[model samples]
Target: MSEKSENLVEIRHLKEYFNVNVGFFRSKPLKAVDDVSFSIKKGETLGLVGESGCGKTTVGRTILNLYKPTSGEIIYDGKPIKTKNDIREFRKKATMVFQDPYSSLNPRMTVSDIIAEPLDIHKMSPSKEARRERILELMGYVGLNSEHASRYAHEFSGGQRQRIGIARALAIDPEFIVCDEPVSALDVSIQAQVINMFDELQEKLGLTYLFIAHDLLVVRHISDRIAVMYLGKMVELADAKEIYDHPQHPYSKSLLSAVPVPDPKTARSNKRIVLSGDIPSPLNAPSGCPFRTRCAHATKKCAESMPELKEISSGHFAACHIL
Candidate 1:
């Protein structure tokens, strides 16, 4: 469990589709996450990245069963998470840090009550005294003091509120956490602090993370490996440094090229890659390859069939007909 040798979570051909009404008495499936697959190893951080509406968030939600999968399998720690009891048990081992701190927390409840919600639901504490002690401990883990316990969520700043949310997620002693844009709503200065705290907590608690975010710099900093999504499908996955340095997929390359280089000389030398077309609606996605419509390297073969995500180099994968 200490070493990142075995996978802690595995998603197999996962699909999540919502029915959207198109016309009178007519509906079509909006494939939010379509046939996606990847894994996160024990004690590893796997960054999931893509533009908005690319289904990265949907994939994270689907993994935790917050939104049930339309099809495909979710395996956690080598076991299928299918039965109600299985899901219940899985919740104890896994939790989520939602995107927005303001919306996720209850303004009505005190910080202590909010942090203790998971402990209360699962009956983790034996007595009222034990619960009080545990609440303080959890708050301390996230850098909140005991005096802040009586304060409601709205009284605190966004960063502190997010810290409370993190404290809540850690309440159940979870082994895995799906951080759905956890720092996206925070101030740029505060974001580094929270991200660093996440790293520290992961080291202390032996936690694995499926960190869903669009900020390439953030993802690059926190992830050991990264997965890129286009439309509703996964286009590339590789070691974080490798993907940033040498993205193979057309969509992946376009994404990496758009990341701003901090060095003035490097920034001047960098050629910006701009895609031609807007992202197609999921309801009316292009045939075959999901990225084909915007990909400059797309050929007739790309439109005829979707490319399988296959290993190109050791531990690096990409889906492209041209490759």
Candidate 2:
């Protein structure tokens, strides 16, 4: 979270494939994340947006080493992360804020206990008094008071539960955080507050985030750069404004067009590009480009060979045969 210009985290050819059983003794590999590569700079927010089952969450989890990637290297601070010791060291510097707050927190434990769990595991504080102080500090940082710390997770509202989750993630003072749809489950009004809190917390703590969400509007607001995924492959990646204004890939263009324009004039002028066909199963994904099945611009070449994610413009990247 320091003001370092160097890349904080680098994922190279990251792949996460799950084995799916078909026949009595036969099982095929489901490529959840297929040859994906990206990097997050220090103190920058990288937004990852995609439809359900596009491997957005899988990328985040795999980066955290929670789900062991089938292949590829994860480099952090110039160190290649492999083995349990490396992952454990990485955990001290990296953390994740889950999407569902209700299911994330333990119902039996109090807020203080839940927040202090990381500190306890890491042995951050030597004394009980020091641990209490750290827990209180985290609560206050997330806009929770000391009185609320004694209460259980079930007692809080949806937004408040997420705040608790945020507090817990911050407890370890991690530099990089994977915010997995932190505000998606919250109400519209509460979403703004929580989003603002995340923004504020980032600035104050000098934190970096891989902000993953389904809502393009929310992602655009918080992310410095945006990456689009379709069927376990990254189709587009560029600056947030550039992606919004001039999306290159067919899938990327379709996604940006789907974001509802507020103004009547703009809304009327804009045409929504609705994609046909359902997302294919990762277990039986297309041979070439994974999105070729749904992409209108797909051709014989698209089905015959896969397209690599190449830079179309400065700092703008997309994977497609056509521009």
Candidate 3:
């Protein structure tokens, strides 16, 4: 496909701010997603990685219109989403596999019903027979048996519940999926199973993904490209291998340095670049650059203004005064 045609989703200067209650008669804009932009190519997995509360999940939710964006544009398949009709149509084309599977599923509903909820909402299956058949087919895709379909979510393991969630996400036959830390809640072994299942499903269905997670190893394993976020802003984004080999931003360096290396020799040689302080509250963020508080390379320019995320190398983008 041509480069322009290759892009399935594009985000432009997306910002999602929430009004927080600080004290009596006090409020502030908590910049959850602050001027972030990127794109996901057709049938490719774009991993978004950051520490907790860095707005990774918020970005995904905002794009799907689960939480309306405070500002900026969300374009799907080259068309900008604006109207309620656009969102309704977008819902059928895109879906999410939430981070917490246990709470995401309803205790009142059976596995079959949970899987078929999207189908019913979209009026996908005309007849009851077709719905039942479709639900069974989806269950099979996620390695669940037909017998398990009638069971409640509480009866299954964490892995099984997540599978049910994934099956539901696929019910709409979506072209794009926002996977919000989909494997983080499972066991190490189960995480592998779920991650592999995602890979298999993407290949089989030609799906595009915005895979959000804090797990660097998982992101590295699945992503074609990776974007690093810090204090609600995108610090760096590049090809997965490129970022791993040579990250441009100081924050990216620190994050990658902490990823546990399996090799005894490599693990022993790797130096962890630990940051100096806890991430500052979004409600009281630094004036210039949010990462400057902990960055070793912070300079006067960094404190003066936030650097723009721009291309330093071919398809490699970073925001830092020192770089």
Top-TM-score structure, candidate number: 3
Report every candidate's CA lDDT. 0.94, 0.93, 0.95
**Candidate achieving higher TM-score, 1 or 3:** 3
- Whole-model lDDT, model 3: 0.95
lDDT of 2 by residue, 80-120 (tens): 99989999989988999999999999999999999988888
lDDT of 1 by residue, 89-200 (tens): 9999999999899999998999999999999999899999999999999999999989999999999999999999999999999999999999999999999999999999
* Model 2 regions more than 4 Å off: 1-5
Query: Pairs clashing in candidate 1?
Result: none
Which scores greater on lDDT, model 2 or model 3?
3
Model 3 residue runs over 4 Å out of place are none
144-190 in candidate 3: lDDT tens per residue?
A: 99999999999999999999999999998999999999999999999
Whichever of 2 and 3 has more TM-score, that candidate is: 3
By TM-score, how accurate is candidate 1?
Answer: 0.98
Pairs with backbone N, CA or C atoms under 3 Å apart (clashes), candidate 3: none
Model 2 TM: 0.98
Q: Can you give the lDDT of residue 9 in candidate 3?
A: 97
